[model samples]
Target chain A: MILGVDPGLTRCGVGVIEAGANRRLSFIHVDVVRSDPHMSQDLRLLAIYNGLAAKIEEFAPDTVSIERVFAQENRNTVLGTAQAAGMAMLAAAQRNIPVALHTPTESKMAITGNGKAGKIQMERMVARLLNLNTLPTPADAADALAIAICHALRPAGALEGGEREQHLTPAQRQWAQAAQRANHGRGVKRGM
Target chain B: MILGVDPGLTRCGVGVIEAGANRRLSFIHVDVVRSDPHMSQDLRLLAIYNGLAAKIEEFAPDTVSIERVFAQENRNTVLGTAQAAGMAMLAAAQRNIPVALHTPTESKMAITGNGKAGKIQMERMVARLLNLNTLPTPADAADALAIAICHALRPAGALEGGEREQHLTPAQRQWAQAAQRANHGRGVKRGM
Candidate 1:
């Protein structure tokens, strides 16, 4: 099982999924853990930590994937996001489960084959890929599922270039080809 | 006892101090908790959380004071610093100790009577106030001590304007007068 988290102070999104043979994915659970804004920041952070810790214990995921945060993004919210991300990472680390960070662009590209894909497009892609009949309400949840899928499709040790095509499953290879086609088509259109 | 933290991923500084009648302060302990830069971000954050958690458990402080972080500061280190601050706050909250945030300006003002006080001046004031024969070696350790003193001098509920001079002890009032004098002297000099 792989768990994906979109960390935030007010509402942290968490999604768990399992990858099967041939790279098929199944969604296990998705939810938003919320903390009151009126509460002191320390208490708010502790609430987030506790909420995520419980989910990790319940799911016992093999690996945890979280959206990587950058200080440049949303200056007002970046600090809280970083703090929330820290809690998510800490919860997984305490259990000895490996944690991975995927950038927003990486997740968007993995799901919609477009690094700059819009929210609705990403959500549609996530629902279609997860084989869900309905959309993942509240964009954060969808974003989290996309993060998890990004991890599942990533080549092992791909970030460090430790793995190559030979290690990719047939399904992942197929998906990679499709993404490349999408990227090429977009590039050509922009060049026009 | 009060615990103060100067949060950073590379070296989080912690200081424990005791406050007696008439606002006298005694330094109990001070140390820096470090996380290796070579480790993964998740593991490094976990190491920080564990190190601070252990300290909180050992000292059983009545309150935790941490340096407030702003995204405007050094973009390169802000995220890591915010994450470290989160860990410090979480460690205190988990143990039910109240946590307070004091900005660098607030700490400096409390220690040196100048919001723009330089590093060397802040260290000297912290050492003098704590009656330490030698200065707090690492800047982070001294910063933590300064944060603690900030909280100790602040009037109860002062941040929210809930308390007034009637509640302040003689020592606290005297320190406040001294700080005002320093600020006035600096203003006069700058005008000249």
Candidate 2:
């Protein structure tokens, strides 16, 4: 499954697309998960983290594709968006899932055939690609769908790297070592 | 040593404050780590994470206090900020050390006796609190100092409550336990 995530502070548009046998997309689903504004920023981020984790569990997508943040004028605004995007990445990472980050230009080009395509053009392209009558609602959902289609077009050669380095940190790797040191050393607490 | 992080997109400002006995604070280090603008958002966030961890190891902070994000515009911007925040949080959490999250209002109230305070007001208060002749360079560095001050103001009662809630996920307790299980399983597979 190649899942697309359009992450934002207010609402994260998620699209799941399963690239199946015979080169056919066997499944697709789209929805917008809204992040709470009334809560404190930390709580809102916690909501995003848990909400996305629950959604990921429900969808069980083996891979996730998230749009990359491009540019921002306000420093504060950029910080909040970065936090939300990080939470999405962490959610996928915690589940040991593969993630491919797509820049806005790349995602735009994948769906609209032009990097500078307008929002409506990308929406129409996504609708056409998914064989839907009407475009996905509220532009963000359509953009998420387009992002999904972008992942679907990933060349097999690119995927040859095949799901390593997505593991935990070097410290985590150390803890995975044999018990030789555990028993060899005097009883002592090891820092993570 | 207490490490305080004021996460931002272009510049992630950090301050290391040594809170010695008698409630005295000495500036250990102050720095702003910059991320490449052209790199993907994930890479920038990863840079922040790696840089923060290296800083912690270098400074050997006994405590960490990070300011909570409160910006409320541009959903994409918020997501990015949240990503940086999450990365910082994850780094601390992995260390099994308790981390304190302080909001802007609380930090302001602690330092300046006003919950609603501007950046200049904060910089001035920080200068007065630490009795510094000159203001901390760039508002971000001073904000980081304020976060450390916020942690220094932790009452005995506050410490108990805060210590108890280390990574406490009310509803997601089950999920974290499952994750621990998977981690242990991986450890076993790797012959730990």
Candidate 2, Cα interface RMSD: 11.6
Model 1, span B28-109: residue lDDT tens: 9999999999888999999999999999999999989999998999998999999999999999989889998988877776
Predicted structure with the largest TM-score when compared to the true one? 1
For all predicted structures, in order, the TM-scores are 0.85, 0.53
Question: How many residue pairs clash (N, CA or C atoms closer than 3 angstroms) in each of the candidate models, in the order given?
Answer: 0, 21
What candidate 2 gets wrong by more than 4 Å, as runs, is: A21-23, A73-76, A155-192, B1-64, B67-82, B88-146, B150-192
DockQ of 1: 0.43
Best-matching candidate per lDDT: 1
Q: Per-residue alpha-carbon lDDT of model 2 for B106-166, expressed as tens digits?
A: 6776566566778888887677667788999877788888888766654332334545334
DockQ, in order, for the candidates? 0.43, 0.12
Q: What is residue A128's positional error in candidate 2, in angstroms?
A: 2.0
Minimal lDDT window, size 10, model 2 chain B: B167-176
